[model samples]
Target: MKRLGVLLISLSVIACQSEKKTTGQTDSTNAGTTSSSLTYKYDSLQVFSKTTTAIDKGKADTAYAKIVYPIFSNEQLNQLVEKKAIDAAGDVDSEKPKTYKEMAASFVEGFDSVNGEPDMGQPGAWFLDDQTKVLVSQPDYLCLEHSNVSYAGGAHPNSAMVFWNFDPKTLKEITLESLIKEGGLPELNAIAEKIFRKNEKLSPTASLKDSYFFEKDTFSLNRNFTITKEGLKFLYNPYEIKAYAYGSTELLIPFSELKALAKPNTLLSPTP
Candidate 1:
């Protein structure tokens, strides 16, 4: 588990660079021109990342937790940098952007709340571990994956995944509706369901009840997905489409598969 944590932290700082650059003169007359002439190309992001940890120790009990997440730092490309930095720097705004440290603290607080107080009589330690990384950070898109594993005197440690995609230019989260063209959901859903069934190793005629997926026997695609130069990848976290024992599932729908369905000039379309 420690190795897993180290790998995730190391991944955050790799291959990060600014897309837009200074391209004009320095004179006052050219100052306005400089601001107006700077062009933003679709490529990659300049990222700032930090890891925060918390440890609570008592006479007979102790708890530890940590979190790692990245921040997009291009002013024109991402508007959340300043606010997120402020929150990370110890600002007390409840509505302000949250830092990785804050995320870890919240997890610790929740564990304490649910368990009431640690048992002073127990001689062992309680622990919480969380790690997140940039799965893809490109000029037009960004994908992040978060893994949180924790235990507070439970039968076993539990882990889950959180996936996020955003439009780098506007710094807003992306969704299925934004990527697919009008009337494309039906086609997309049909394709995704077929892939889902195949991944589950069920025959074409097999029913959802044949497996541990949604007790309701419903077949639907998860809204969590990421875009890459090659294709669109949809992810399903534990207990999302199947029992936790079955673990996570990932499906890749290549650009060719969605070529006619995805809206042009969006993340889903093939990059030129």
Candidate 2:
């Protein structure tokens, strides 16, 4: 189980950098001066291995990992992205992997080492498929989505999806608190709960205690949200607010509903 944890963490780190094509273009105008726009590209890393044993005469245990992440022109932004990816992947020890390639290698090596143990019982081949993509690329915000499916000798494979938002100009993470006005969270949550009920087709006054996992039968907004052209999109992954069998739930709160709660000059603010 410990090795399984390591494999999960390492694979997630490697999954942050997969290959994708992107181009940078400059807009021209009648004026002599030019304004440059920010752009990014992507690269990928992969590692795989299998273990050999003399027991069953050809059933080898295998491990594989793949990762894709974006590369920005700005070095500061690049470093920040790398740091965030590593952090989100989960820490192992003081001497953790420093790059995506190393992370992939670590995952493969960990699985192979565990398989080589003399008394270890054969479970099955293990694999990790991870992908990270630019979900939304706008002038003010950049949203990244990381998703992965993995099996580590558990009862069943697991899948997860995560989103990260960043401020392009400042290279800072765009937190929900940063976009909302002070004392506006209550109103925002109320609006979001209403929409959530509508999306789930639940009556407005329905009790959540029986069917949902809210702490006190009250709905609340989570930080796992992304900014989209249509609205603020939130994702509740499997087992997050419901049983794993229920899968994920998506809630999109329109920008119009959040206009009063949004702070001025932020991405959610309406243009004049």
Q: Evaluated with TM-score, which candidate comes out highest? A: 2
Q: Which tens-of-lDDT digit does each residue in 104-155 have in candidate 2?
A: 6665666666776655444666776667777777777778898867676656
Candidate 1 segments whose C-alpha is farther than 4 A from its true place = 1-61, 74-99, 109-124, 270-272
Candidate 1 overall lDDT versus native: 0.55
lDDT of 1 by residue, 1-272 (tens): 11333333433422331112233323432222112222322221222222222334634444455543343335543235323333333323343324443334443333333343444223334555554455665666666565667665655566666666666556687889998999999899888778877876777777787565664886777777777666778878777776777778888887888988888888777557
**Candidate 2: deviation at residue 265, Å?**
1.5
Report residue 226 deviation for candidate 2 (angstroms). 1.4
What residue runs in model 2 are displaced by over 4 Å at the alpha carbon?
Answer: 1-36, 52-59, 91-94, 116-122
The best candidate in terms of lDDT: 2
Instruction: Please give the RMSD to the true structure for each candidate, in Å.
Output: 11.8, 6.6
Candidate 2 residue 122 Cα shift, in angstroms, is 8.3
Q: Clashes in model 1: which pairs?
A: 43-139
lDDT values, one for every candidate? 0.55, 0.73
For model 1, give the 10-residue run with minimal summed lDDT: 42-51
